[model samples]
Target: MICYIYDGSFDGLLTAVYESYYMQEKPEQILRKEHFLPDFFIEPIYIKTSKEKAYKVYNAIKDKVSHEALKYVFYVFLSELKESSTLIYRYLKIAFKIGKDINLHMHNGIVLSVHKISNKVTNEVHRMLGFIRFKFLASNLYYAAMEPDHNILQLIMPHFSKRFSSQNFIIHDRKREIAALYNKEKWVIVDMLKADGEKLFLNNNDEVYEKLWKQYFSSITIENRKNRKLQKSYMPERYWKFLTEML
Candidate 1:
């Protein structure tokens, strides 16, 4: 009935792992403090986030385990799945014991779960690279919006930053209300409000371009060869809201 509560950050989660080892106790659940609900029977222990302690666990996963294991651990964290903290904790325990061979043991449920969720997050990142449709605002900044299944704003920014390095752009995750903003030199993730995002006005040229793009999209379609099912498989209905052609 022992549970650990943390600050809901990657470093905070790592610090919880460090505390478990430091205290020599195994917690049944490791949850973010904000998400923790009081239980009459369970004893919840709050773990403070420490940069030094977090780094200790982080380095151990990379040095003791494989660097790829560290990457999988991070992807799982970004997934925001329920009981993900506990899942990661169990995965790391097995990883520490088996070292790099942990990846080879997909037969293990913990290893398999970690890999599966990590791949789900990664696949979304790959899909988003092509699916992102940017429009020019009145301020000349390029803007794009998405509501992905995972928290992948920071994950996909490196690609856009390189591809559009000469121009400023904002990739907004509407679901998370957070954005990755690049100013032609450096990129930073910041919290943005719905009103703020909605206020971005498209220039006349951009509006015309959107109309032309939509027309081109329709012109390229063959009525007889159209496959709605196949198109839905590649471009899910959920993403249609942001696609100009779909609109």
Candidate 2:
């Protein structure tokens, strides 16, 4: 058995897929080099990322498969699952063989796994859209922090960018130490350290707004009608840390 290691980028995974065919070595597993654990029984091969090779494989998937299939591959990669790389490889192998009809083959385990994982990423993207709470910063920037289960920071950028098009904002993913910064017209993702993030100060009036909002939330709640279970079902306890009312 052989294992192929990549740099953990989406392009790197595609490049590995390209090499697997050209090198004629069928790997038993494809893993990111940063997370790879040595296997005594498996021979390891390190695959370098190539934009040209990655582009060719990417185009092949879009042309040979469907545009929707291409989306599945991307979302599955963003899932950051330990076996995501291998799952993508197996998925495309079948995808290329069967073409766009691969989506209908839910009976196949590999196909089912890909769909399930991709759906999970999509679901989180939807949830984050409503869950994100922004606070005004001292610099007139809107800042919010979250620690989602998946690497979904990039996926949610479009919604916030359009919604807050006239304002500057930053959405920080505390777990990943990454943030999306938007300046009215454009947005970009950047690496942010926890210590640096802590240096950002909230606007002086932000506390007043938070207090008023919390009070409003409390005033609207009827003690007799409160259903902790239902509330938790809609807004999971795991996300309470970042919510103003929950705080």
Candidate 3:
């Protein structure tokens, strides 16, 4: 069995795919460096990420495959599902063979798997878009923190960046240990693995806003019309921790 190991970036995954096709050796599994387990029987090949190689593969997908196929590839990558690397490799293999109609071939296992994972990622993005609540910080920034199941910070940043273009903000993904920092002019993602959440500078007026919001939420709640199950279905319990009213 052959295992291809790479850095955890999407570009690195594409580079691994490029190497596999170039070497004419298909790997049984493609794993990130942290996930690769050593085995005497399995041949492990470490793949270095190359921008040129990754760009080539990306261009091929864009030029040869349909735009929808490229979109699916990105969405599936963002899904962060187990064995997503191998799934993407297999999906691309079949995609290149079957042409632009590959997505239409739902009977194909790889195609179906990619489609399902992409749906999961899309759902998570939509949920985050609705669930995210920002708090005014003492630093004059709007800050929000969340621990989404998938790596969707990048996917959802554009929405907030556009809506709050005039203000500076930070969207911290606790699970991923990363933060999307947006200034009034532009935005950038930063590694915040060691960031102290407790040190977040909250505005003095935040408490007043929180109290007012919670009171408004309580006033609007209809005791007779309350449906816990339905509410949970719409807004998962996990997200309530970051919501001001839920707090």
Candidate 4:
């Protein structure tokens, strides 16, 4: 068994895939460097991230395959699922052979798995678009915090960036210790772990809006028609911590 370890980045994974194809040595497993553990029986190969190699593979997929297939590849990577690198490599092998029609091959296990993982990540991105609640901070920046199950900050940024194009904002994914900051123009992601000392300074009037939102939420709910189970189905409990009305 051979294990290919790479830096934890989409480009890095693509580089590894490119090397595997060129070297004619497919790996049994593809793991991020941080997560890779030595196996006595398995030969471990460490892959360095190369932008040139990554770009070559990326362009091949985009040019040879359909753009839609490329999008699916991106979504699957953002899923951060276990052994997703291996799954992506498997899906790509078939995708390259079958071309754009690979998406229609639902019977293929690798294709189906890729579709499922992509759907899961896309679903979370949709949920975050509606559920994210931003607060006005002391620095006059709109700030929101989330603990999403997937690495979706990049996926959801374009929507919010276009919607709130004039405003400066930050969406912090506490679970991943990363934050996306928009400066009324373009957005960028930053490392924001607890130890980073990046404080969120909220204005005094922030509490006023929070109270008003909570009050409005309560007023709109029909007491007799309240259904906790139904509400929970639409809005999971995991997101309650970031929701002002839920607080």
Model 4, residue 130: what's the lDDT?
Answer: 93
Candidate-wise lDDT, in order: 0.90, 0.91, 0.87, 0.88
How far out, in Å, is residue 195 in model 2?
2.1
- TM-scores, one per candidate: 0.95, 0.96, 0.95, 0.95
The candidate, 2 or 3, that scores higher on lDDT is: 2
Off by over 4 Å in 2: 202-205
lDDT of 4 by residue, 36-67 (tens): 87779988898999999999999989998889
- The lDDT leader among the candidates is 2
Best by TM-score, which number? 2
Ranking by lDDT: 2, 1, 4, 3
Model 2 TM-score (2 dp)? 0.96
Which portions of model 1 show Cα errors greater than 4 Å?
202-205
The lDDT of model 4 is 0.88
Considering summed lDDT, which 10 consecutive residues are worst modelled in model 3? 196-205
lDDT of 2 by residue, 166-199 (tens): 9999999989899999989999999987666667
RMSD in Å for all candidates: 1.5, 1.3, 1.5, 1.6
In candidate 1, residue 18 scores what lDDT? 90
